[model samples]
Target: MQERLNIVPFVSVDHMMKLVLATGVERFLIELAAYIEEDFRRWECFDKTPRIASHSAEGVIELMPTSDGEAYGFKYVNGHPKNTRFGRQTVTAFGVLADVGNGYPILLTEMTILTALRTAAMSAVAAKYLAPKGARTMAMIGNGAQSEFQAIAFKAILGVDKLRLYDIDPSATARCQKNLAGMGFEITACSSSQEAVEGAEIVTTVTADKQYATILTDNMVGPGIHINAVGGDCPGKTELHRDILLRSDIFVEYPPQTRIEGEIQQLDPDHPVTELWKVITGQVPGRSGGRQITLFDSVGFAIEDFSALRYVRDRLKETGLYEELDLLADPDEPRDLFGMILRAAKPTPVAATVGAL
Candidate 1:
């Protein structure tokens, strides 16, 4: 019989890069979105809760966890807008997938890249149900680390390739435009958010600032427009003005959490908002009319990450892009953790012979 070793498959940053490159980026997002949508279709069967967060002056650290009866997953992630000054990423993350039967982690991965990918995928999935049919133009309001990914996701999933990019820093916009060159996008670098949103069928706000800054004004949103609100994910951070939320039909991943961390926090606690899962499951309407505005108040959710991890696990055997990590204690005899440690402290027969020589 094969031994049950105390090891898990760990996908490091290097391995993640290889895996993503090995599988084309667009194809990965499309496939990952399918996993996310599938989970939402069965949303009733999983454990759901608001992400537990630790906030500070610098930024926020959060744990997003969820499980279907048979499998469990969680991600440890941080959002620090000031990290760029120190030559670091604004967000960094890692996640684990485990078996619910025994609670042993099956796969562990670096989610800094995965989070960006999943966040973009989640936005596209919401757009699938809520965005206007045949929407092709998107206003990318923030050109930070997540902007390019958002653009690629929309293109891959929704066929949105006309991008109007904007940022407080022109350099960020330049960087975003340069990165996406020849990616089949009709690109425009706009001077202001108002200019960026002009004639756009969909708008995505993905800034990384950790404050209550309104990136979108009421006048910027128009009829038949879909807003992918991605940045206001913490208690005091927001992107769109409260007036905008009042006019739009809002959808979210989890309401208990969105009320505290999403754009809906600007509205009354009891204000009505539909869960995106419900729309995917066809329990409610998505776009009631071509003249009505829709908002996907997306704060990253555990279930989406759970789906992303599951997709990565499914691809491991075919890709061979992960490293095995000995991260658990599996004793030959049950309840023999101490004995296992003692056994490790002793030298092997070959080591003893080498010492004798």
Candidate 2:
């Protein structure tokens, strides 16, 4: 065992892809959801706080952090929807999992892909409790980076494989369909959001625009339907109209944060909302009636990211999907860090003869 104090494991984008491929996408989602569920069960044990964010005219950058008494984890993520216009991903992230006892990071990994996976898994976990019994088809309103992962997670968890896809840009829908080809989905590319939700048991609105846009209106949603409102995860940005929010029983990860970032931002600050952890812990009911509309106001939370970090750390040993990194400083003397650094400096070699210029 490499017991170097400064050696932390790093999983780059390539290793993350290899790990996901080796684990299989659906299986990975299932396993990741299990980890999320486990953490939610013990939700009160975590030191929770809303993510720290910095906003600008163009986009927002955020730091999500949390600790479960033993392990500390945080993710640095940025969202700039306009990046897609310039051939860059709208969201990119990397995270670290550290030992709470000594504040030493044990793992660092790229979370751009992991965030997508964890967000999908969190949505699926919420839907499993709140969605109607035996729900099948889903209306995916936003065919962007998060659409396919959401579809696969629902498929792996709740057996939802039928997708009615739509996006303002038809090319994005085409790309989404093409990416998810042969994934055992009965796909229908619709021109309008209304057409997409015509027969959907679950309607997911995941548009990437960084503004208040009603991707789903009051009439677009129906009774007994579950709405996974994934976009609108920031201040001044939302996806659903106010009327739809009025008719739905909203479930959120953190109310203080969601009220400012999620679709419920349209509702009153004191509007009643149930915490997802309470529902997961059986302290509160999820879906009460057949005609009740359930809305998961998913503004990605730190606990979910922590769970994703934990899941990836466990998988590293089995798949060998991480590289060791010298990230710590271990001096011969506990208090001699500076001496260790100076001693390791390159010896002053014979100065190269300066060419007479």
Q: Identify the leading candidate in terms of lDDT.
A: 1
lDDT per residue (tens digit) for residues 1-357 in model 2:
356776899999999999999999999999999999999999989998899999887788999999999999999999887897899988999999999999999999999999999999999999999999899899999998899999999999999989999999999899999999999999999999999999899999999878889898898888999999999799888999999999999999988899889988888899999999999999999999999999999999999999999999998888888998877777656698786667667422321111111
Residue 95 error for model 1, in Å?
A: 0.3
- Which ten contiguous residues of candidate 1 have the minimum total lDDT? 348-357
Please list the Cα RMSD from the true structure of every candidate, rounded to 1 decimal place.
3.1, 5.2
Which regions of candidate 2 deviate over 4 angstroms? Answer: 346-357
Model 1, TM vs. native: 0.96
Over 19-102, each residue of candidate 1 has an lDDT whose tens digit, in order, gives 999998999999999999999999999999999999888988999999999999999999888999999988999999999998
Clashes of each: 0, 1
Off by over 4 Å in 1: 1-3, 348-357
